[model samples]
Target: MSNIIIGTAGHIDHGKTALIKALNGFEGDSTNEEKQRGITIDLSFSNLTKGQQNIAFIDVPGHEKLVKNMIAGAFGFDYVMIVVSAAEGIKPQTVEHLEIINLLGLKEIIVVITKKDLVTLEQLEEKKEQLLMFLDTFDFEIKFIHEVSIYEKESIEKLKNSLFSINNSIKQEENFFRYYVDRVFSPKGIGTVVTGTILGKKIELNEKIFICDSQMESKIKNIQVHNINALEANISNRAALNLQGVNINQIKRGDLITKKGHIRGFDGIDISFKCLKDKKLHHNQTYTLFIGAKKVEVKVLLFDCITTLETGYATLKADEKLYCIFGEKIILRNANDTICGGKVLNPIIDPMKKNQKRRLLEALDNSDFTAAYKELLDAHKKGLGIISSTQRFALSHERAIEFANELENVFVDVKELVIYPMETKDFIKDFIKIIYTKNTYALLSNASINLRLKWASTAFIQSALDELVNEDFLTRDVSLYKNSNIKEDFTKELETVFLHRLKQEDITPTAPYNIYDDLDIDRKLGDDILKSLTAKKQVIRLQHNLFIHFESLNKIVKEMKNIIKEDGFIDISNFKTRFDLSRKYLITYLDYLDNYSNIKKVENRRVFV
Candidate 1:
């Protein structure tokens, strides 16, 4: 193995020191207090070579006072060396360490028992059996066992050969360049420098490195692996670097360095908290949040008009503002309840809620463009719309113009970033539903952005609409579009009612049945007719209670002539009495006629214009 991290686990004075010396042929305890007090205080380091494979060893403290130090030491290793002394059987630190390992999500393990020579062969076997029982419960198993005292000058090769069988054969990953800084110092000749385990990928000399979390940048002057000048370091290998352009004071542990603006730090996010099965919480509770190398203080509050936090349900609120992006992992805690927490649903978000809907719309419009492109296929399934490439850039978060080139070729599409699939079938159904109900055709421009759907953004709605039009599921009339496959039929009875009412007085009916004696339908259908007429512009919609067929006033006037032909004027009361209609209705009809100057209103009475 080119680079594989292996760490040791056991309580204080469990022969961790002697075991490392026996396996690696060296002493790792470096601090003066450790050598004087005869116990590991902080973290210690060593190297184990098994045949052609080499593995680095991290030995952490096991005393109760130094548990936090142990956590910091083992936080990033991929494998563990679980040391159980044959004489002692099992210890509290061993179980606590196991819990920590589980919480960190680690699965790889190598179990070892030390000081086996002190016990009888039978006793050693019994102790091994007991450790195995505990191991079985924890899902960890030992691959090798050696019975030798710290004074043993033999069995080193046997232990080394066993390690060879288990060490990973594959070389380190060289794709994602990430290094967790564990040591920082200045050499006699070199100014500011840092060292870390180059996890996942190697780096090129003189490459521009940026501290994303800190927003700092520098040029790499040199690289060293295992104290040798190296062109590059592979993932899982220890590396030291000389950085040339930044002040040492600004560089600190927990500061992640990468390409500038490549990793985004978000302030607030939408998260789901797993309420403990029985614990109830009130809003605005404070907590300490631990994620990766950073620990932040969080303020938890219930979401959207609710105050009490009940079990089994999740709510939204900012416990703290943490900068992050999609797929980033987060944990929330009530500082009082150390291990109780939740994960963020949306890792990147704005902290403010004032005008949240508007902010959401703007963010979603941009988010659609920057999100992975696979989501486009989903959006295509539903439909598509138009968004400026600028919006796509905004959605890219900290990646900048990198995704802009990828998004330029497509026109109105159900689009997503490179990863998420967009769903469009429901959108098309809704599109058809609206058109079917309104009895109207929509241009692509209007259909692309129906105000009814409330799709986070106009751009997103249009994206879906345009996709539907292009796929031929719907037809576009230049700037407009509508569903082409749809055909709605009215019953003959309904058609006759509509046509006769329109033909009755040679004008469109304000509404069919209300003006026609022969026309009739169910109450629902009557409502449909009125709505359809308004959409068709067959009748104009005015103030709340008024509607008029174009010829109703005309027909009324012809009838009025015989009774009032010689009159100088007409009274509103007299007109309503003669028309046999409510005064409000008659007055509204008269007002409509007056607007056309068919009659003049002179102080509550009307005369011919």
Candidate 2:
């Protein structure tokens, strides 16, 4: 039956306790001091049940010293009972308490006129008129108000019925759980503890949550509401919580401990606010700004008091250190107290401002995804980059779609807060593509001085040369990339291969394609091909691919002949294997090797001379 908490508010000794006793048939003020004085010093409570709903009455002290106590009582109440004495009518405490309610953002309230028996018809009418005048200036949206006298029997029943109806009329808007800290105490056996009304839902034990922006996490150890050990507290109910792993020294009454990364702390995003009409607001004038459990004095930069505040509208800033990120509603008070205020743009970030574009843009440049795309495009214009969308948006997928749109020129698709630009894929296969065209099919020796470039990539030049065979750029016989028939002025190509291969294994050459993989190529065909000089004896061919066409194989043959004649036996296999040439090509030039009269081929791979 415990579902709603109804609080009584009015001047001191406004028959608040008497009224509660009449409603629930119980004395809510149980303390000796309060009983002796007939005034509620601390918060008093009683429960009235009808059918299945339980309504607890909170009789708060109307004294000025007890305003903080009033706040504690009101923290968990579902609906407020604004009790005004019919005899005394409206008072200072009534207005002050109303201000407190508005500050806390209470929405449901019912006005109760008590002690109607003490006033006459004309007197009651006059008091009601005065109460209406006061109530008209307040901000809350009240559903209904009624008159009742505690001295009459069933008067409490009448108020209880009204409260029950009002409670039924109320609805809780579903949102993430938020508990406003009202009291912090040390419980027996348990260390530091805090209490507040359960804002919404059931909290599980051992759940870790953040204390606003401190980034510190606290663990929920235990909970209690109204001296009851509630296994799980629901919304609109008061509760105490024992938290562990966080020092009470670090936590204060206003600290909001919540799930990490749930709420953003506010900062210097300029806001539009409605100031009190009579308050003088000058640009750059500093004032106190209170935003949800936090407050500071900020300067007013963009505001005009003459611009018609309508009692609750203005845009201003904070000159002091404070944090209330976004989607948090805030109030603007001058050096003097007031509650004129505004709401944030969204829950994720401070609303962007025009005046501080440079600073905001700087953060955006470092963070905003779309702006990053623009930077990416600029880099493309400079032929500079292909940066990731994650790097562009700083990896905060909160604004991922809008962040991806920033890279729209390239194309963007977002999934799971990840940005994958289309440009990233566009270049994957077509990267560095170049079209090679000719007037007609080119011969291996006829294309551009008989030199075909397979590729320009340093990592895959040899593969690209192999690719050239696929592309019909060169013959399949082109083992070395330099197997081109390209004619060049210098013998550098073959000579470089010779020097490298000779330095590698130094096997005597018998052919041209004597490539050992360990021997690195220093060959560049266009500039390094070895062309025979027809005017001089600069070429020789000892055997097959080992040809210097200018000496026409004679001088190399003579060298081979001298070796065989002088040594009595020749090792042509050693020379033939080194240049990868066949023995037939060696024999065709063997007479050129001079044979010294006899030539015999050995089956065990020997050369006979």
Candidate 3:
């Protein structure tokens, strides 16, 4: 079922409460003080269900002193019900309330002229004309108008039917779960219960959420929709959640409940502001800022201009941290009057430098949120560090990845939950330069590349090198990287020199140190050439610094196989005597034969497999 939150807006003694009582059969003023004073001083809630729709009424205080409370309660309303007494006509608060409703961007309204029986028909017609004229100054159109006497039963029933017939025009989208705490109290046997209108998404039973102000966590024990027990509550509906792990005294109005770590509180923000009154907003002037269901003191710092009549950019330094985001509406008031209101441009931090402010304002002026995010990326692209998804974008890990994938930029995933943009062309150019300068068969170590490109991260350098290797531009050999496009002529020459020296020593090959020293070659280069020879089957590596010709290794393997077959098994001492070799060479040759599956070692003997 869809829900429509209809809030009452008008001056004191304007019959707002009486009008709700006539339609719902209950007075919205629940406190004795309101009844004694004959005026509402706080917010009250009631509901009426008809067919598949639920209509929740929020009655706000009509007095001037309680306008802050009215602003707090007006956040989640879908429509405004402006009630004017026909006998009293339009008053000061009537205009103020209308201004507030307009500032909230509510388009639907139902104008109800109450106490019709107290005035003559001519006086009532005059009041209706005056009300229509006053409404013409605003942008929203009234959907329906009714003149009713609550004393008459037929009149009450007709108003109720008309209200129920109003269609819900707003389309709700699936979003993250977030609910503003408007009313908090401790009910007997229920622990602590918090009531508010759900804005973005549904909240389920037993789900853990956090208080955005204090970062305190709690779990939902139960959910109620329109006073009926429910396991979950839908968006745009009035819901009361029974909570555990948090005390009633710890929570207050304007505290937000959302997924843990999804929101952050900040003491400074940037906004696009517009002055509603004729007064000028001076620099460093303090004002009460009403945002969502919270009110805080903020000092305004105007940019590029002195006064704000039309929309302009400004920074607000709040006395305390406020949990807000971009695109939220803000209402600013001085000591006595409502001066201005606007949309929040950015939260979580303030613009420190002049160029940063200019760029941010330009991005907001000419583009949407996607462009603004790209601008933020551009600022960090010059620096060599990664950007944090939570700090920069104000999003969770999963959501930030999704958002980044949707943009035109490419991000390189790194450790510590950070991401850096991959400048593909620049990195590939630098990598190719490093490989081309080496111009040798021997591969280069990662430490050498790191010394040349000190600005890039080790992970980024490794990733770029891997990309080159994957594209067949480079080949790797155990911590060494070589350019694949380099000619193999030098490697073949070195291999010829190494193999010829090994063959000169017959079955007992020359050690690697003697070959490199006699050939007048670098030791590391000699190792590389020997490894290449072993890979090509031209030489067999027996042990560290020992090499044997492949033909000699084959001869030794054939003799070992013949001996193992004839004797069933070959003992270590007997094998050393048969080969006419020392214990070290015999052991090395026998182990090599065993590794190639020519023989299997059992205890101290070798057996043919």
| Better structure of 1 and 2 per TM-score | 1
| Residue 26 of model 2, lDDT score | 77
The lDDT leader among the candidates is 3
The candidate with the higher lDDT, 1 or 2, is 1
TM-score of candidate 1 relative to the true fold: 0.55
Worst 10 residues of 2 by lDDT: 434-443
lDDT of 3 by residue, 1-609 (tens): 768889999999989988888788667787899879999888888988887978999999999989998999888788889999999999988988888878777778999999999999999999999999989988887889989898978877888888888757352433467788998999887899999988766889999988888789889999999789998988778899998878888888888888786567789878777776565677777888998888889998888866543457888898778887556678888875888777777775743467777677666655354565565655555221223344333444566556665766455453533344556435544655555554444455555555555655556567777877887767776666666776454557668767777777756776786665455444676788888889988898889877888988888888878878878877677686677776777788777876865567889888876
The digit string of per-residue lDDT tens for model 1 on 1-609 reads 456777778877788777888776667677788889888887666676645566777788888666555665565566877888878978978876775665454567777777877788899899888877877876554555565566655655666666667656233342246565655677687888877666545688988887665577788899987677988866666677888876777776645555554445555555444444455556666655554444566566555434666532232334433444332234444533324344434444433344543333334434543443434333333333223221222233224334533554433323342221234434545754465345432222443244344433455555556666676766654454445664444343454456455546442234443442123223344455656766766545444534444355466656555445656666676675676766665656556556645677778767776
Residue 116 error, candidate 3, Å: 1.2
Residue 473 alpha-carbon offset, candidate 1, angstroms: 18
What residue runs in model 2 are displaced by over 4 Å at the alpha carbon?
1-9, 12-51, 54-78, 96-107, 133-141, 168-175, 267-271, 280-327, 334-336, 346-415, 418-609
- Per-prediction CA RMSD (Å): 16.2, 17.3, 11.9
- What candidate 1 gets wrong by more than 4 Å, as runs, is 50-52, 141-148, 169-175, 268-290, 295-346, 350-609
TM-score of 2: 0.53
- TM-scores of the candidates in the order shown: 0.55, 0.53, 0.71
Cα error, candidate 2, residue 328 (Å): 3.9
* Candidate 3 lowest-lDDT run of ten: 382-391
